[model samples]
Target: MKTDTLFKRAFNDALLLTSRLRDGDPIPSETTLAAELGVSRTTVRKILQTLTEQGVVAGAGRSRFARASAGEVQPFPEAETVPTSVQVEKQFMEWMLRGDAKAGALINELDLARQFKVATTVIREFLNSFQRFGLIERRPSGGWVLQGFTHSFALELFEIREMFELRSAREFSSLPGTSPLWHELRRLRQEHIELLSEIETRFQDFSDLDSRFHRLVNTAVPNRFIDGFFDIITLIFHYHYQWNKKDERERNEVAIREHLAYIDALLSRSRSAVATACRRHLASARQTLIRSTSDTGSVA
Candidate 1:
């Protein structure tokens, strides 16, 4: 059988077994269970092992098996995990970081609660912590809003990021311990090029490339703080860089070429060339954004 099919069967069998047994129902013998499920003994063993790990069932000596006790609903099995508040906040945070979270569209404590399937109180506390991180805000209306960055914010972000990259390239290019940052940048730049070639849809593709390229650039920087800059920069770019909607393709290709140049300069240790490339790259985005804003008028 195809691995996909086998895995599906194994999963479905486990789910069926889980549903069939009542709370505290006696577990069946492995052989009987395997035969009944129409699966091989080894497959049954693997399934049972997985169930045991999930806290759904347990066993004892001489092949005895039993249902999970009410207390057995532990933190949750790896497969059936209930995402932590942090994890839920993280999902909401991504949208705030890169999404256009208008007043009506903003994610709040209630949204997080529904999204994570946890209590509203948990989400509220977590969102307050995000506000402390400067990632979100609560409105006077009892609704919460996500604070996004501006174009100037993006410029400052990239500037800080470049400083980190310049230092990392200088240090790691000649060092022995840490991984070469330039190499990773080159790989991601290549991936950006590939994405450009493969995608034809407009904003969505650009959005994806925008995210990936910035991440790649940030990776060149050694500091995590610098890496965090991209998180904010993405929001700024998406909100401000309108680019006439028609220029998306050309804009992306030009970006790809410039990124390639940036990576080349970093690899070759050409500081002047890197600085020049970065300037032109940013200027292009600025020009496009300004043009788009002018076109957009009060519609903005």
Candidate 2:
């Protein structure tokens, strides 16, 4: 399909799956979103025209489109966490649960792209990824609508992490009473501890390393099953917890410290210590999840 048509399909499909909403759904102009989505104004206009032609939305003064009906989705308020793509989608899901129909408000694409500091195509691609997940549905008249609960999705992600991480924690601690890996584990643990000793409150590291840290530890077991188990865990984190921007903190040094403690527990060959450290780490992660409830109340 032509690039012009591709964006229209994405935009319209997103509308169909999502319901109507109330205040603060900044549905803007085609001219603007066209730039935001990185397509031509003609392309965006085509999307608006298509939606207008359909009964889903009505044009507002030839500039914007008001929904044919504003329905009942509420908002899920959250703060900045791992602000990645997954978090964006979770934000949208929360809006759906509130029955907040305002999610369809068009954003200034140029502004959005600028704020994200990324090309519009990346944003568009992120939105498009949701389609395969069945999170979004297309309208006959040509618009998209969100169809899932945001909180439920977020919770589901956490539950899955708990199951995988707990088991991986056990395997990680299964090293021999005296293995060379123990020394390496000791070094990383000490550093992790010193940082944690000076701990404060909320902190987040918006890097793949945060993820790689877990993977590296679990993979240390050198068993196919252990590796496979965490591969599943990794997939969930990749898709569900993908965040956009991380909230800044004064003491993220604590997490690195905890990670080292976890390493120490594993090297000591003490299952209890390993599990305790893992639980502590996961608890902190859960707090981050809770705090990440987006106040802006938009989703991927």
What lDDT would each prediction earn against the true structure?
A: 0.57, 0.54
Model 2 per-residue lDDT tens digits across residues 42-106 = 66666666655654456465545456365432222233223356545454444343445443344
Q: Candidate 1's residue-wise lDDT over 98-203, tens digit each?
A: 3335323466566667866667887787777656434456888776765444344334555664565555445433433355655666677677667667756542
Model 2 Cα shift for residue 95 (angstroms) = 12
Off by over 4 Å in 2: 1-149, 176-187, 190-209, 220-247, 294-300
The CA-based lDDT of model 1 is what?
A: 0.57
Residue 262 in model 1: shift from native, Å?
1.0
Question: Which run of 10 residues does model 2 get worst, by summed lDDT?
Answer: 73-82
Please list all clashing residue pairs in model 1, or write none if there are none: none
